[model samples]
Target: MSDIEIIKAKRAGFCFGVKRAVNITFKAAKKGKGVFTLGPLIHNPQVIEKLCKEGVCPTENTEDRNIQTLIIRTHGIPLELYQTFLKKDFKVIDATCPFVKKAQQYAKLLCDEGYQVIILGDEKHPEVKSLMSYAGKDAIILDSNQELQKIKNKKRVGVVVQTTQPTNLLQEFIGKLVSRVSELKVFNTICNSTALRLKETKEIARRVDLMIVAGGKNSANTTQLATLCNASSVKTYHIETSSEIKKEWIKDVARVGITAGASTPEWIISEIESRIRDIGGNGDNGYPHESGRN
Candidate 1:
């Protein structure tokens, strides 16, 4: 049997917010309600597909009039759409993560206080878009320190961040804005789960020769995890499922580290582990050790 050791990151599965959102959606589906989500509940496709089969339809927009029950994604939605849903009298259930909701509230607080609100994240991201809406249409979305040049000598600036954004980026952005803006209010709204995942994955990357990050390809957090690992000294591969684990990638790899995005389900992690064991060129007992977490 080939000798292989696998290390699984403890934080490598669904975070609290995603678990809460999935539970809420499944519960609604079991009640036989016409359950619907404004967008995919979470980034993981497998989870979304499973929910779709359970009759939780994902709508591109809020135009559907017959939707009996609507669930807001964990990423939250625009304030305007939320009001529209209320006006239409649709039974709305908000699944927005507490951290995301806090950011939204912070944005609104800044706007009401007449501060120049600046969102530190990708403008196209739904979370940023929603947060910006709360801040006001005039609020600026700043993606980088370079973008800060666009700010025209504001008196007071209030800043909020996307929940999934890297904490270092936020600190750096604030550092630059500190000198430019006379009065600055910086709110660090990154989720705890996200911070933990990054820390754990980086630790694992240092210990293992090969690192495999598991989750949906389009998932921003997942992509970030993979990017972090890839930039490190270890060889890292980002895969959505076990089937993508190539024999060549694992060839001659004695130690492998596995980390999944927050949205990944437990079953997917297990499948990836099992596949790694099989692809390590040993069916019997290649997996000598697995530590860190489930």
Candidate 2:
């Protein structure tokens, strides 16, 4: 067999939202005061650990009266929580990604205009829950096409999605609702960064012998990328760090592809590439410098 080669997605890792969130958190930490994120600033543990070293930490609840500065993550919190912080006089640094902010705005707008807002995402995800609060008590969360059947009246339905959700899932939910609803308005709120990553990952997966999805396990976008890759019927592995890589997995593979979620850092990707090269005896494959096209 020929020597192993590595192919990587150009758009993978640290999209605008994650970058902004990390930057804001680090800046706050630099002030050398107590800084608390309403949740983990982003999904990558390595990044979180780095932030912890800088004096930024995640609190389980947002009602931390002890912390003077509250940093919202890229996935914006519920409107009620934002109000609560304001009421408590906590100095708030909103690190919510612009893409997620847009989704919240669109959901709120639809609900205010008397349309029944339908969120297409995981009902329990922090971002989706936050968006639901913006949509008011009447909003519905549709996780699958079957859930759409339960929606009543179906007229004046407004559609929005979690930024990390696959575009096809959102489209499938909307397509199902369009037939049942008399009036449907879709905001297409899925982040372009996410869409691009998914597209590029899927493309790379098609040409590789195995796909390694690098990111924190808890990261929604990272898991979604792995799911997309596995759907291609290729061997796929999701790893949080380079140490997790197993030599046995790549024994027979001659070509491997690497991709990361929006929250993944460039260093982690580089580390994974290095490990793969050492184990598989392949050159760098000129990732990040290459066009990233398969």
Candidate 3:
């Protein structure tokens, strides 16, 4: 009998927003050629490759006059960049996630209300950059662990969080802001899907002998999942594809838990699971259990 048991997260694959963006891209591809996304539709390389095969490609700039249909990525683009695209002759298909769109709206509203806007997330991230555009020139980007002295002199502060940020960060950031600013307003822009995935992944990490997190390295949500797994004190491997799985990692492991990011596809997760089983001898494999979907 095989010693390894495999457990899978029920909600381990593509989240609603990602699924929507990908569907829209494929449908656009079928309609004609010269389809391009402002950036990657989603972070997963495999999915992007498939989209390319279907004639939909990703472009970083709008300078390419040949682009017939420009689809906005799931992360959305900066306000000025979006406006520039609208004026061009190319058809613009906005596939920005609804949750992200809400965050942008909130950022603009906060600025109009005369509060200092603070966005909680990585300053370099595409989504945060897009949020900053709506928040105006003076808006500040704050990391959860960073000092709040920048906003100390301001009487009023408004906050918006990245859609994939952990809930604890928001709670903690607000706790600190309450005392420093006389009036504080917050828009909880974090996605519900993100919260559920992190919660489920943490629980599984605690129970398993080893954790395997599958998704694109550049994907923020995927990286967060891997980080959470490591913090749980279980041996963890963050891999983009099944080929990354090594035989020795599972040789002696008794229980393996598998989870994926919002950008991951179901097929990739299945391949990873299959690889683990094959390496562990596939004979009398420990029964697999499924947690509820995200």
Highest lDDT among the candidates is held by which one?
A: 3
User: Per-residue lDDT for 1-294 in model 1, tens only?
Assistant: 344689999999899988999999999999876789888888889999999999998997667776889999888988988888887756889999888999999999989988888999898988898998899756999888889888864788889988887788988888888988789988888877888899999999999989999999989889999999988878988888898988878876778999999899999999988888777733334434445421
User: Which candidate number has the best TM-score?
Assistant: 1
Q: How do these models rank on TM-score, best leading?
A: 1, 3, 2
Each prediction's Cα lDDT score? Answer: 0.86, 0.84, 0.88
Tens digit of per-residue lDDT, candidate 2, span 1-294: 225689988987899888888888888888758788876888889998988888888887656666878898887888887887887756889998898899999999999988988898888888898899999777888888888776775778888888777778877777777889899888989877878888899999999999999999988789999999999999999999989987777765678999999899999999998888767533233222223432
Tens digit of per-residue lDDT, candidate 3, span 168-224: 998998998898888899999999898899899999999998999999998878999
> Which whole-number lDDT from 0 to 100 does residue 132 have in model 2?
94
Model 2 steric clash total: 0
Candidate 3 runs further than 4 Å off: 1-4, 281-294
Residue range with the least summed lDDT across 10 consecutive positions in model 3: 285-294
| lDDT of the structure predicted as candidate 3 | 0.88
With a 3 Å backbone cut-off (N, CA, C), the pairs that clash in candidate 1 are none
Query: Which residue pairs clash within candidate 2?
Result: none
| TM-score of each predicted structure versus truth | 0.89, 0.86, 0.89
